[model samples]
Target: MTPLYQVSDSPAVVSKKYFSRRELMPSQNSSVWQIQSGSVRTMTYLDDGTIVTLGIWGAGDIVGSALSTIEPHIIECLSAVEAVALPLDRQNKMVEALAAHVEQAEELMVIRSYRTVDSMLLKLLGWLAKRFGRTVDNGQLIDLRLTNQDVAEILCSTRVTVSRVLTQFEDQGIIQRLPLHRIVLCNQETLRRAG
Candidate 1:
């Protein structure tokens, strides 16, 4: 697949760089960064200081000031991240990339809003596999490390519930944890029909 924002000779894009884990990228009002490798999560705290996971973006994803007016937001690396710090002025110029970002974000919101835990988790895995995973012998391997807490925040559920559902999935041979804490979908059909 073509990267959303490739390191181009075009004057509109420049300053491609890497970001370490937990490192802060440009803030909400700053220039947008297009993911070239790895993943990033942009989030904000509630008045109660609770952390919210706004979005998880991998290669080919574009994020930052152009995408949202999300205030009090922080962009942190979930893994070692490589991205192009796109010029803010050119943000609206990349119509296709912007549309992809908006569509993925909305899809995530709808998937996470499912009433049942099984439905939510299953849909999330399905979407993640499609968006981030690569093909493997058994199934798609989502190479990102999504912890219980991360799942909890995305699904608006408790960590314990996330853990329970994950364990259940593993027991049922629907999913498995791999090295680097990556998740592998063992049964694509089962996940698709779970909800």
Candidate 2:
């Protein structure tokens, strides 16, 4: 992964900070976090106390304690993370920073609106491939250590279901699991083929 310090123009990085795995970033008010390296997950509670994951943000992605104006959510570090806190304490930088990701936000909404779970997952794989995967001899390697539970949260499915679906994909030769939590898209063409 590229070091965050290598970036030449992120003035918001003055408050560069580090967080341990599973540590929660402040989530009480509206604030934007600029991820330098590593990843973070944001989640909210349902009326029945169920956890609904908002998103898994990686490098270059921006997140907030409560991104939605309607609900309060928690932002936690999924892995050891280095980021810059753009505390919305005084400036309208929050609005400007968030404006940078308008297109990413729209893409996520489209992916989430898919009617079928498999379709949604497939589209997500394609999206991730474009966002984070790299071409290799065997296939496209997604450079994120995403687990089934993490995927389930993003897809609003159970870990059991995510595991089953991913296994099924491997069985069909669409994807392969590498050591650790990495995934290789063995058949990108097949994955992108409309179902």
Top lDDT hit: 1
Q: Summarize candidate 1's per-residue lDDT along 1-195 as a digit string, tens digits.
A: 444443557866577788898888875344678899999997765434656678888998877755664456578999999988765544445655675667567567656656678778887888888788898988889898888899889989999998899899999899988876689888658646632
- For each candidate, the alpha-carbon lDDT, in order, equals 0.75, 0.71
Q: Can you tell me which runs of candidate 2 are displaced by over 4 Å?
A: 1-100
Error of 1 at 193 (Å): 3.2
RMSD of candidate 2 to the true fold?
Answer: 13.5
- Per-prediction TM-score to the true structure, in the order listed: 0.51, 0.49
Residue-level lDDT of model 2, residues 81-135, one tens digit each, is 9988765542446554554465366456656666667777777787787788899
TM-score of 1: 0.51
The candidate scoring highest on TM-score is: 1
Weakest 10 consecutive residues of candidate 2 by summed lDDT? 1-10
In candidate 2 the C-alpha lDDT for residue 184 amounts to: 80
